[model samples]
Each structure stands twice: as C-alpha cells, then as structure tokens.
Target: MRLNHALPPDGANGKPVGKEGDLVVRDDELGALGNMAFDLHSQLSTTGDLARQNTFDAATQLFNDGLEAGSALTVLHDAWNTKLGTLKEACAHISNHLDYSKAQHAKDEHDIQTGMKNAAGKAMTVSRIYDYIK
Candidate 1:
C-alpha cells in the first residue's frame, strides 16, 4: 500500500500552517537575532562594569564619611551586579546557540543531499525516496 504523507491545508490538527510550513528556518533572521544578542552581551559587559565601579566608589566614599546609607548603597550595588551578570550570561547563551544551530543545520542538509544521490550521482526518484522513508 502507498503511504500518504501529505497533510491537509490546515494540517492534521486543523490549525493553519505557516507560510513556509512548520519547520522552515530563515538563516538570515537567525543571524540577525544572534548578532543582536551578542551586541547586548558586549554592551552589558562594558557599560555595566563601568557603572558598577562608579557606584562602588561612591558607596565607599559615603561609608568613609560615616553615613549609614553607604552600607545600603553597597548592598544595592552587589545585588545589581548579580542581576547584570545573569542577564549577560543569558544573552551570551542565546548568541552562541543560534550560531551553532545555523552551522549545524547547514551541515545536516549537506549530508542528507549527498546521501540521497544515486551511484551515478543523479538525484533519487520520488519512488526511491519513499523507500528510504518507509
């Protein structure tokens, strides 16, 4: 018996499919998102470091002048640094993962196309393709 792999326009669950179908990946968009994440990571690392240092210096000066608020400010600075570090790490992970995904997808597609070619280097027919899938 022939296998019917085609789904209806609305898909098996009756939900409308995307313009390019469910699994389409736009490489350019992925690259753009990755670049934005990398930029955020870089900005947070440099600017966040400068801001933290300035706040720490001010807090130290206040403490030296016998102000109680200096201790509170120091605590605030520490909390802010911890939050900033977490955000920077998340941005770095996103950037790195997207880059790896794009490269890996390209490699997978290359391997699949190479494997599907016949011994004579011609593309496999539709019937032969079904045999592999089955």
Candidate 2:
C-alpha cells in the first residue's frame, strides 16, 4: 500500500527533489495538533462526568430494587469508565508529547544553525555546508 504519496521522489543525484522533498513541519501545525488533543481530552472528561452523574442514581436504584439489569448496568458503567479513562490518558499523552516535540525541534534547529558557522563567526557557505553533511 502506498501509505505516503506526499513524499517526494529521489532525484538523479539520489536526493529528494520535489515540493515535499524537505521534511518540514511548522510550529503552528504542531501547536494545533496539541491543542486538538487537549480539547478532545477536555470534552471527553466533561461528557464522561456528566453521563456518569446522570446514570449513577438510576444504576443505584435498579440495584436496590434487586433486578438483574441493575447488576448488568453497574458492570456496564464500570467498563465504560475504564474505557473513558484510557481514552483521556491517550489524549493527554498526545498533547504533552507534541508540545515537547515542538520545543525540542526548535532547539535542534537553533543548535544546527549555531553550529553551521565558522570560527570567525561567519555563516558557512552552501558548498561547505553540503561537504560537512556529505
């Protein structure tokens, strides 16, 4: 399966040569993904709490009335809560990891730029930079 058609094809020089050749990700993109994950986590937590509160009384009453469904409802509620917790944790992890990745990449770029300078504090030429990479 062609999973990623967006990637550029190799050029004659064995280097990627197309619009998507360079692996580029903007800070805003990472921030937006993180924000979305955080929003999903918040929404899930809020909805889960509201649903649990709305059902708690009914579940308790059914159990008090000694119905088989009460036991079933309690079990279902517990299972739903467990799944919801897992989902929330995953969303939190995604958000936190993205934030960390964005900051780390920025730092990496800064370090790379800083390193690409001569001892006299001049920026390295393109050919010189390519030589170092090669």
Candidate 3:
C-alpha cells in the first residue's frame, strides 16, 4: 500500500507549503508527521543504539525499514533460520561420532593390553618349568 509520502518533495527551497487540502495532507502524507513525534520517543528509550530495536521500541523506524526499497527482510529471516538449523544438526552429528570413536579406541587399547599380559605370563611359566626340568 501507500508506504511513504516523503513530504511531497519539500517544495522549492526544501520547505513545506503547509497548504490546506494539498496532496501532502492526504492519509499517507500525514504519516510524515509521525517522524517528528517519534523523535521524542527515541530520546526516552533505554537502549542507545538505533539499529537493534524491537517493533514496539522503535515502531516508526521498523515500519520505515519494512516499507523502504521494496523490502524483503522475510527472505533474509528464513535463510538465517535454515542455516542455523543445519549448523545445529551438523554439530550434534559430529559430537555423536566423536563419542563413538573415543569408546571404540579405549576398548581396542584394553584388549591389546590384556592379550600382551597373558602372553608374557605364559612365557615366564614355560621358562621356569624348563629350568626346573633341566
């Protein structure tokens, strides 16, 4: 719909004529007056930064951004959400693989160590028996 009226190009020397029944006085044109009203609200806000604000915090600015430049912020939001979900899933899968690898490695090491101990004990017993019989 009628997003911005822009003060009817501000006349010849960048001044509003302020005439009665002018196109600048239409419904959409009336919104330009809101910019002046919100200027006061901006000073009273808790957050100092202007870019990061909620819908209610800086409604005029938010609406202005939404209406500016044939805007398409919804696409940006959807892309961000999709990428975030993918990253989360990838991290979870990597964590699971890491846990499984550690468990398998520990089990393999334990088995190799147990086998070596058994072999050494048997070799020692056989050598002792051979010496005893000699």
Candidate 4:
C-alpha cells in the first residue's frame, strides 16, 4: 500500500493536523479562560481595595484600638491578591503554551506528509520497474 494513502486523511491517531483535544487547551477557549482570570483579578482586587479603605476609614473614626486590627487584616489582603495574580499568570501561560503547541503540531504534520509522499513515490518507482522486468 502507498504510505501516503494508507494513513488517515486528517493525520495520526485520528486528530487533525493542528487541532486541540477535548481535554487539552484550545486557542479560543484558553483565550477566554485567560480573559476571565484577568477580569476576576481586576474585580476582586478593586473590591478588596475599596473594602480595606472603608474599614480603615471607619476604624479611624471609631478609636485608636482599630489600627491594630487594620494592620492584621492587611496581611490577609496581600496574600489573597498574590494568589489571584498567580492564577491570572497561570491562565495566560496555559493559553500561550497551547497556541505554541498547535503551531508545532502543524509543522510536524506537514513533515510527516512530505516523508510519506516521498516514500510512496519511491515504492511506486521500484514496483513499476519490477513489473516491466516481468
């Protein structure tokens, strides 16, 4: 059988040349996910900032004792913001990596197709010679 013709039309393992798997990150889907992560980070960070400002304002209006509580709360707020930043970075990284993978897969598929075509052409040449000799 011709090597080129024997394989699936799309590519190896039934996947298309540059398509993403259901479990793997897709370009469009991952982009959306990254956007959502950014939006969440923005919204949450803004809310946290406003809440902290309001609490501090209220505490200062009340008495001197509230300063210590506000100081303690700052630690928790910083930690939460740090975590949200990490999450946003991770989503962006995933989206970028998947986009790179899709391009690489396409290049690899093209190489495979070229190799198979060459092999098939060579085989045909040899077979034709043998048939002519007989």
Q: Which predicted model would earn the best TM-score?
A: 1
User: Taking the tens digit of each residue's C-alpha lDDT, what string does model 1 give over 1-134?
Assistant: 12245456757665444433455558898899999999999999998888787899999999999999899999999999999999999999999999999898889878786678778988887688888889
Query: Can you give the TM-score per candidate against the true fold?
Result: 0.72, 0.71, 0.35, 0.44
Reference-based lDDT, each prediction: 0.85, 0.82, 0.46, 0.57
Off by over 4 Å in 2: 1-23, 117-134
Off by over 4 Å in 3: 1-71, 115-134
| Candidate 1 regions with alpha-carbon error over 4 angstroms | 1-23, 117-134
lDDT of 2 by residue, 19-114 (tens): 433567689999999999999999998977787865767788998999878888888888989999999999999999999999998899888866
Better of 1 and 4 by lDDT: 1
Residue 121 in candidate 3, Cα distance off native in Å: 14
Which ten residues in a row are the worst by lDDT in model 2?
1-10
Q: How many angstroms is residue 130 displaced in model 4 relative to the true structure, after the best TM-score fit?
A: 19
Task: List model 4 lDDT by residue over 7-99, tens digit each.
Answer: 356456754333333235455765576567556656655664566556555555544565566565656556766776676667556656656
User: Candidate 1 local accuracy as lDDT?
Assistant: 0.85
lDDT sort, best first? 1, 2, 4, 3
Which candidate number has the best lDDT?
Answer: 1
